[model samples]
Each structure stands twice: as structure tokens, then as C-alpha cells.
Target chain A: MPKLKRTDPDERATDFVESLDRGLRLLQVFGTISGPATLSDLARAADLPRATARRILFTLAHGGFVATDGKLFALTPHVLTLSGSYLRSNQVVTVLQPVLDRIATAAQEISSLALLDGDDVVFVARSSPTRMFSAGLDIGYRLPSFCTSVGRAMLGRLDDAELAARLKAMRREAVTPQTVTDPKKLLAAIIADRAKGYSLVDREAEPHFRSISVPVRRYDGTIVAAINMGAHVDRVPKQELIERFLPLLRDGADDVKNRLL
Target chain B: MPKLKRTDPDERATDFVESLDRGLRLLQVFGTISGPATLSDLARAADLPRATARRILFTLAHGGFVATDGKLFALTPHVLTLSGSYLRSNQVVTVLQPVLDRIATAAQEISSLALLDGDDVVFVARSSPTRMFSAGLDIGYRLPSFCTSVGRAMLGRLDDAELAARLKAMRREAVTPQTVTDPKKLLAAIIADRAKGYSLVDREAEPHFRSISVPVRRYDGTIVAAINMGAHVDRVPKQELIERFLPLLRDGADDVKNRLL
Candidate 1:
């Protein structure tokens, strides 16, 4: 393996107003890890010098976008203000929330809205009862797009070349015994999902978790995101997911797309 | 009147990398008043040369953060990813969502979380079943801090000098007849809020909206935000807000603080 260069020391001496890039790069650092980070951790994650990282963090902190406990720095609830703008400005989330609420109440399971982020799926909105799951799944969580139903639903909308490129880039590590590691098999599953207009993944990402999903389209008929219903395998059988949950997922996606358009 | 000289133009200019600030400034121009902006409009808002603004807009359009229909540019949902990181990293939101949900369900009204942003209060989280008298009370929306219960709760925690400076900086225009624009009266109200550990604003921000709020503290006892319950003026009387809602608001705020800590 080639040696990985961490930071380019020479770039520090240059004076360029890359503040926009610096600010965005600072956000990307948080995506790489889950917990709060100290100044040194942020500097290393963004591949910037400590002084540079400190300046960006200070500005963000002052803007009420980020918070610090004098020791560790983390993103603040004020960030939702920005995301709230998107939720309100767009018709998708507002229309989808009620439909998702209905599905969660009906199935007594977790339902979510996810969009593709490069090769991963990022959860944008979610609804779940307090006692539904042992490990709570909140918004902003990302998961590999290879072994999930929402991933397949999104993948179903891509053309052949785009699908090939995506499969070529994915690492086919087995997350569970049921996970499909072979590119050929994954492609076949995606093709089937396209035919049915929905997808189901059974214990692929986790042993006891299963999910069913459908693609959500915009007014222009372009697939933009996905809605999925998830439950424990012991509670929901594979056939019940297809028969009972698929319609709710499809209707919710349709409702969201219709309102947004 | 003194001319408002644009502050630190050189420092602000250097804050952009390859004119990325010019690009972000173009995006910020769409907030509140201006929904969609033409090319010339964007150039003026960002104070950049027309060609510079066009180049930045072109790049942003390709990045999917902005959309254009040949004449004007509008924000796309993709832009939220930049701010979404802040929502994901904040433990406060994760703790507060359940509380907001309970309050909204219990009261059958709007429940929200807000933080002090300079002289304004910005909504961070809101749970509402329907639109009431306040039409645009969504997440990320900003309102004058002096006119809101959550704002007053947050202000009550500030030191005397800090609070006085904030009042001096605010515009003294009354939003409604009930709004307390007189500095002395407002100061007394804030003082009373501090003594009682909660705040109530009746028909101050809007004629038919009444709210009660309590300060949310961190584990170290620093007030970081406030939680509020809002109802239509006719549904919840001023006396009932203090009697029925105050204790619940305080309890909910305590629950969120405990969970976050």
C-alpha cells in the first residue's frame, strides 16, 4: 500500500480565502465520525492545520451554528434551523411527515426518508416510537447503500451505466450472511426492484432487522429520495412486508412527491 | 443619519476562497424577503461583479445546491446537507424532540425549541399539527427576541449588562399593541421571569398567539436554549398559561437538559 499523506504542510503558508471550502470541509469532518471532537481531532479530520481549524471552529461557534463545552466541540441544535429551512422550503418533508407518521403507527415500526449521498444513504427524516428499538436511529445517520432496501429502491432508478459505475466502486464486504457481496447478484436484485417498483432486504444489514422501501420522485418524475419501513425480523415476516407494508410505503412516497410537485 | 459603512470589506473579501464567499453570499440573498433572484439581483446582493456572480452561480447550480430556470436561481433541498451536519451532531435536538412531541400532543398546539441568536430568537425545532395565527413559525425562522416567551426566558438568564446592551441595540418599534417596547417595562418583565424561572408572553408577538416558556440548561447549569408551548389566544387564557403550562414547560426543559447531559 502507498503511504497516505495526511496534510500538505506547504499549503498552510499560502493566503487564499478558501473560507467557503474550509467551512464545508469542517462539516464533512463531522460526517466521518459520530461523537464530539476536540480541536486536534477536527484539525486531523479536515487535513488542515490546528490554527486553521481553530479559526473556522471559532467563527462557526460565534455564528451559533456550532457549540463547545470548553473542551470538546460539537454541532448545535441551531443547525436544525438550516435544515428546517430546507424542510419548509421544499414540499417533500412537510407532505411526507404525516404519511410517515401513519405508517409508523400502523406498523408499530420505524419509518424514514433517505437520500443518496455519493455511495451512501443519509437519513433525512425519521419517525419511531420511544420503545420501538434498542438502538435509536435518528436523522443524519448514514449507512452503506449496498445492503439496504432504500439503497436498492434508489439504485433501481439509475440507468445501466450509472448502476455499473456504482457497483464497481462499492466494497462488497459481507455485513451479514444474508448480504449480497457479488456485484452481479446485487445488479440482479436492483433490476427486480425496478420491475416491482419497490424493494425488500431481509437481515442484510443486521441479523434481526428487515426493511421494505419505495422510491420517491419529484414533480419532474426524477427519483430524489426513498421511504422505508423497518421492523424486527421476528415480528414481521418477509411476505407480510411485501403485502402489508409495501402499499403504505408507495402511497407515502406518492403523497410526498405529489405535494412537492 | 450616519452612513452604515460596510464593515471590514477587506477582511470579508479575504474570507472567500476563489470567491466562494461570493457564491455563499448569493445563496444567503434568498433568505426571507427575496425568494428567487435573477442574475443581476444576485450580483447586487453579493456585491460582486456580474461576471463573478455568474461564475459562482454556475458552479453552485452544477453542484445541485442551487437551481436555475434560465432567468432566476432558487435554493434546492440539496443545500440542507451543508447545515444538516449541525443537526446530526447536536445532542440537544435528539433530547428535545421527544419532549416537543409530548407537549404538542398534550396541548394539541405548537411546541418549539428556540435559542438566542444575537438580538433575535431562531426556531430550532417545532412540532405542530396545523397552522395557527402565526403563519410562518417554522424551523430556522427568526423573530425579534423581545416579543417571544422563549426569547424572554433566554434573556432572563443573561447578565444585567448584557441584557441592557441587547435592548439598546433593538429597534423599539412595537410589533403589536400588547408588545412591551418601553425599555424599563421590558427590563422589569425580564427580571420577573428570572425570579420565577419561566416566562409568558400574551399577544405580544402576534394578536392571537400566547406562549409560555422555560430555560433549558446544560449539565453545568449554563442556559443553552429554551422550550415553549404555544396556543391560540382564545384556547389558552393568560392565567391558564401560567397555571397549567408553566410547570409542564419547566419539567420538559429539565427532562431535555437531563437527557442531553
Candidate 2:
């Protein structure tokens, strides 16, 4: 099993330089669980003592990045400026969104853009109709890279040595019955994805859901991210996913690369 | 004139504490000005010396928030995770996006959620159809509070003293012929917005565009933000804006409030 590393609050708090890391950890705590948290809840969530959590919350509130209503502390709209800055600076989102919108409208399925982050894929942009799914996957959801189409597409871009290292460190526990747990089979699947120029994941991360993904390349021809079109297995047959969705996904990726380049 | 602060790069460079601010400024420089920038381009945009810009850019590149190709630097999708944290932490965005989407779909116009920042309004979220006129508004875009329907709606939420203080510090300038440049008239508009529960502006920020806006309240009854629907003047007449768009904007605000609460 891969060793699980807990965010060490004590180690983070020991040095003044690490306080930034501590502050980021406090921010990260908000995403690890669902719902808003009170000061006490934040302290427990961040694994910091109550007094330390109070100071960090106070400072964040003073900076207008977080809001407190005399009880619970939640993020403020100003916090979006941090991420909005990222989206704005990176023109790929602006370039990709219209393409994703077109794909979503044409295919009538959920379309998403994701990037590799340590053994996980973080969703950066998505376009979907309201009735398709009640649990709306917004801009921040992170999922394990081993089980999702976007993950496989991104991993397929990496060289064998790096890919092997990543596979060696992956946690192989099944998220669903169809999840690829065997290392050798997963490696083969990744190799197949590279040859095919796209990846198709079926009921791996969640049962009854199918996703097809293609890599988004930069002007230099390096794979920086991947795009995916996802839907229920009943709504989209595997053959239909490849035939109908794959072309649109590839076209969208090409458009993004063209506009960005 | 309101004091224009120069972002002090020298003070920022020596202090490790200011690294966050420096890093954030580097990200801000990338917003819409250019796709990829050389070190000198970043220095000019960030108003820093080449050396300072190089250091910050190098650190960001090392952190995977940016990618450099020897000559030019560009932001990567990994930066989205920072804003993603903020979006997930604030439950309001989840509640608000659907309402904004509905308004955009209904009106076939640009709809946005904005929050007050000092004497300005900063857009946090926006939804728009392909034919919609954006008026150059994007998330994190800031504009004066006196000249926009969304700005007036948010300003209406402030008490008299707070409102006066904000107005007193602002430098009123003509954006377009219809812009409200008079302080007294702007104050009256704000008061009227409070009484009517909405604000409307015609050709104020730009020619041939009109907008209607309403405040989004939290469960505690505080106006946390405002939402706006914008259309070309030819599509939405003054009366039509108040009659048709107002209810949609208000309904969207109410829906957002219900979900958030």
C-alpha cells in the first residue's frame, strides 16, 4: 500500500516561512469535506489547535478573503480573485470554454477539462445541462487519475519511467467494481490510450457513468491537460461514445490549441 | 482624485512574507493582456524590474502554476486549483450559478454575480449565451460602483454613511455619454434601487447596452452580493428591462438566497 501522509500542522507551524504553507493548508481543509465550518470546525478540519485556527481565520477575514458571521467562517467572493486570476492569466480556459459549450450542446453530455496533480485529476472547467446530473460537478472537484478517462488521457502523455513511478505510488483500492486495480492491466490500458489518441472509462469511478477523454496540447505539442465528455452508460453506449463524442472532443481540443497557440 | 497606489515591487522582493502577494500579482499580469509573455513582458505588465519578474516567474514555473519555453511564460491549469478552493469553500457559488444560467438562458443575455470591493464592484461569476453582449466583463473584472446596474444594486445595500464615504472617495469619470457622473444623481439612483429592490441602467457603461440588477441576500438578511442581466439596447427597451428582466433577476436572486440559506 502507498503510505498516506497526513498534513502535519505542527511541522508547518514550526517555521515562519512555512506559515504560508499552513495558510494554504487551512484553505485546502475547506475542500476536503463538504459544507461550511465554524471556527471550531475549522480547527478540527485543519488539525490545528483552536487558538491557532482563530488567528488564521481572523487574519483571513481581515484580508477580505474569508467571511465570518460571528460563528461560521466561509470563503468570500474575493477568494475567487485568486483562482480567477489563474483562469484569466491562462487563456486556455477562455479558448476552451466555447469549444466545451459547443460540445456539450451538440453531444448533450457533460464536458470537462482537467489537469494532472500528483495521482489525481482536478477539474478546471465544465459545461453541462441542468437535468443531466443533480450532483453538479463544478470547477473544483478532484478525482483519482487511475479510474477516470481524463486521468488516463493525461497519464498516456507521460514517458514510461515517469508513468511507472506514478503507477508504483498509486493506491489500488477499488472505488467501484470496474475500477482497474491490477497494475499490469492498468499499464496496458494506458499504453492503449496513447496509441488510440483518446481514453474511454466505463463505470470505473462511478457505476453507470461513461467518459471519453482526449489530451489538450500546447503549441509546443506537449500535453498540458485533457478534456472529457461524460454521461450515464444507459444514455451513452460505449460505441456511441467513441463514434459521436470522440470527434467533438478531438475537435474541441484542436480548437483550444489553435486559439491558445 | 482617489490615490492611485503603485504596487511596490522592491518592498515585495526582499520580504518572503510578500511572496504570496508577488505571486498573485504575477498571475494578475497574465489576465487578458497576452497569451504568453517573455520575462521583459512580465516585468512591464507587473511593473517590476526584469530581475524581480524573473525570480517570481521562475518560482511559479517550478511550482507548476506556470510553464516557460525559454523565451515566453504562460500560466497552466494547475493554477485553477487555487480559485477552485475558494469556489468550493463558499457554498453561495453553487447556489448562484444555476440561477445565473437560467437568467442567461431566458434572456439570451449576459448575467453576472458581483460583490462590492472598497469603492468598486468585482464580478465573481457570469453566464452568457453566444449572442450575449459581455461589455468586456469577466470574472475578477472591477468597475466603479456608480456607473453600473450591478454596482448600484450593491451600493444600495450600504447604509447612508457608508455609501457617502464610498462615493466621496471615488473619482467620477465619463465612461459613455449616458454614464452617471453627478454624485447627487448617483446617490438618488442608489436610494431608488433600495426602495424598489432593483437597479436599472441604460447605456451607462457602454453604448447600446442596458442592464437590470438585484441584490443577493444571505440567510442573515445581509446583501452579500448583486446579480445583473445585460442585453443590447435594441433587444431590451427601458420599460422592457424593468418589466421583464427585473423579475427574472429578482427570481434568480431569490433562488440563490434559498439555496445558500
Candidate 3:
């Protein structure tokens, strides 16, 4: 899980910080593996020289972002403040949590808010009625935009060229047996979603997970994010999801766009 | 919002990356605000010069960690990947997620995991089944250690001297009417928690929110983090919380420490 791409300081700006990019690269490598990594493990993962990694780790340790068990290097919980920084600054999730909660409660399902990032949809907030979907989804979990309903909902909001580029970039994988992998088919699905004003997917992301999502609009009507409610296929039939959850998702998105904004 | 504490690169290692520290300070500023910020706003919040802030923002933007609307600079959801890195590497929450889910389902309440960081307790993972207390708490939300049950449960694990140092460093603030601001009394409560094998807090951090917490231990039995179940005071009486919620919490913690680890 070593990162191959690195930011070039001299690429565009005169004062772009190279050291900072390296530091972030160091942080990036940690996500790829589980458990504490040795200095060598980190250097190899981030493609940094051992000495350079040591220096950055030390600096991060000093800054309360990294820690050591006297051998392996690991991140401290203080590093969470960084993401907290992003979440708090946006405050969209925080502002919308009560609303998300209400939606989850009313639907008796897992409701979530996800923002489009690169070719993926990153879950920024989630409200679940149970721990069923809690793994990898306590905010910051990324899912392919090609498969999940929320992903399709946001993709539906993208303009033609951007959507085309994203569709082109995606390496279409069939996450489950029901996942749509063809770019053309995915595009058609997104376009249909645009027409329908929401995206509904059945077992595309994971088997037994069914969801329907709508775009979270901005005051300017731009789709900044998407919201959805998901449940096990057994727990929710498709028609029931639309009848019970669609209005809740649409209203929640409206609340996010108009009231929270 | 500006961070005055900058890690000194020359303190022990000459190669300590100062630019990276500045870059993270750029991130620290994001936590204090509630919305998008201009370049100048970022500089003022992080205490960086306009040019320096602009450069760092450019570096971050290039790295896909930050995004811009051609005017205001803000972090992208990819920053969550950083926290995700930490969470995955530890895998504590990921491994325990199903267990937390079960706890939340069994208790019919919000179950969460928190790790101690400095004077604050940062929630690393959460399995909340309802929206009752979902606002302001996703992964990485920080609560004052003194006024929280999860904090006291971990504090209860600390040795006498470390506990004393923490109490001395704590800037006791009355978060709610029932919050114990006295250092000595807080110490006694923590000791009581240690003896009781759990911490019970009633309407201390948030108004009318009652929570009980128990320490999650490593396989070797040393407390690593704390887990809790929270409910409204009206729904859960303290006696019922201890009688009903405590056993579920202890079992959940035991499962996290022994089964997951």
C-alpha cells in the first residue's frame, strides 16, 4: 500500500511546501496497513529515505500526531483533530446530524451523508439505528461512486464533462454480483438517476445492502453532497424503501441545502 | 484559532521538519472555524503569513488533501483518509465495530469508544443506533476528559502520579450544572470508578445526557481505551444504567479487548 504519487513542490507555485507533502505522505502510508509500523516499514511504505522518515516521525511525535512503543511508530488520537478540523470547518455533518438522526430513526435504517472526492464518495457523516454498517463508516469511509446509490446520486449532479472524466477514470470493478461495471451502463444509470431525481441501487456495493439516495443541494442548487438510507435487502423491499425512505432523504437533503447552509 | 505552540525542529533532531509542522498548524486552524475560509482567513486562523498560508494550501491542494473554489481554501474529504490510516493501522475500532454494534443494539443506546489524548478524550469509534446524541460526535470528536464518563474510565486506569499530573494540568471548566470542577473531588470519583470497574456520569458533559463507561483493555489486561453507552436522563435512570447498561458495557469491553485483540 505504498503511495507512488508525491506532490512536487516546484511544479506550479514558487513556495509550495515539499516537506509538508512528505509529512502527509507519511500519514497516508499508515492507512494502508493495520497495526504499528517500524521506522523502516514507514519509510518503505511512503517511499522515503529512512533518515527522512525518522526526522518526520520525530517532528510528528513532537507535534502529538505520532507516537512510538519504543520500536514501532503509530499515530496518536490527537491526529484526529486534523480531520476534526476539516469536519468542523465544513460543519455540514455537525449541522445536519440531528436531521440525519431523525431520518435514520424514522426510516429504521442506516442514513448517511457523503461528499464526492476524486473518483470516490467519502462518507462525511452517518446516522445508523444499529451497528450493522458501522465498520469503516464512522465518517471518512470512501466508497466507489460507480456502485453505491449515494455515489450515483452525486454523480448524477455532475456536469457532463466532469461525469465523463470520472467515469473514464474509474477502473470499474464488480464489487458484488449485482454491481454494474461497464462505463456506458454506469453513465446511463447516473443519467436516469438525474431524471428520477434520486439514485436507487440494489446490492451493487455489497450483497444484501439496498439503498436510495438524493443529492444534497447548496443554496445555489449545486450538489455538494448526497444523503441516503440503506438496509439489508431482507429487511427492506425496493418499493417500500422508495415509499418510506425517499421522502425522508429528500427532505433531509433539502434541510441541509436550505436551512443548514 | 491560531496555534501558538509550534514544534521546534532543532530541539533534539536537526532534521525535524519545520515546514510540516507549519502545514499541520494550517490544519489545526480548520478545527476552530465552522465554514469555508478565504486564504487570508486561513492565514489569520493558523497564524501564518498570507504568502506562507497560500503556499501550504497549494501544496495540500496538489496532494488532494485540500480543495479550493478558486477563492476560499478548504480541506477535502481525503483528509479523512489520514485519520482512516490511523484507525485502520490500529484496527481497534474496526475489529470491535461489530461488538459495538451489538452493544448499541442490546442496550438500545449509543455505544462509543474513546481514547485519551492530552486533556481531551477523542472518540475513535462510535456505534450509535439512534440520533439522540449523534450531533457533534462522529469519529474524532473531542470532549473534555474531566467531564466525560469515557474520560474518567480511562483516567481511573491511570496511576496515582499520572492522575495527579493530569488533574494539575486540567483547566477545570463547568461544562454543565452537575459537572465536578474540583480536582480533589474528581480524583475521588475516578478512584471510585477504578474500584467499581467502570465510570458513571450523569448530565455532566451535555445537559440531561447520562452515560456510563467502562475501560477497554488490551489482551494483557492494561486499559487502552474506554467504551460507553449514553442515553437521556429521562429514558435511563442512573440505577437502571448501572444495573442494565454496565454489564453490557463490561461484556462489550471484554469482547473488544480479548476477542478482537
Candidates in order, interface RMSD in Å:
11.2, 9.5, 7.0
Instruction: For model 1, give the TM-score of chain B.
Output: 0.85
- lDDT-sorted candidate list, best first: 3, 2, 1
Worst lDDT run of 10 residues, candidate 1 chain A, spans: A1-10
Candidate 2 lDDT, A1-261, residue by residue in tens: 111121222222222333344455676687665555777888898888786666566555555666666566666556656666666655556677777778877886668888776688987777764332212225656789989999999998778878877887898778888898887788889999988999999999998998999999877677778999987888778999899999999998887675545
TM-score of chain A of each: 0.81, 0.85, 0.90
What's the DockQ of model 2?
0.20
Record all residue pairs in model 3 with backbone atoms less than 3 Å apart, i.e. clashing: A31-B85, A35-B89, A85-B31
Quantify all predictions' global Cα lDDT against the true fold.
0.69, 0.71, 0.80
Off by over 4 Å in 2: A1-17, A32-44, A47-63, A67-73, A108-110, A127-137, A254-261, B1-23, B30-74, B101-111, B126-141, B252-261
> Fraction of the real A/B interface contacts present in each candidate?
0.15, 0.21, 0.55
What is the fnat value (0 to 1) for candidate 1?
0.15
Per-residue lDDT of candidate 2, residues B23-113 (tens digit): 4566667874656767788888788877667666665655556676656677665666666666565565567878877887787666787
Question: Candidate 3 lDDT, tens digit per residue, A1-261?
Answer: 111123433446666788899999999898886777778999999999998888898889888998775467778888788877887777567667777888877877778888888778888877766445554446788888899998998887777777778898877889999998888788888998988989999999999989899987777777778888877889889998889999998888777676545
Model 3: per-residue Cα lDDT over B179-257, one tens digit each? 9999888988898889999998999999999899998887777777898888888888999989999999888887767
Highest DockQ model number: 3
Residue B179's lDDT within candidate 2 is: 90
The CAPRI-style docking tier of model 1 reads incorrect
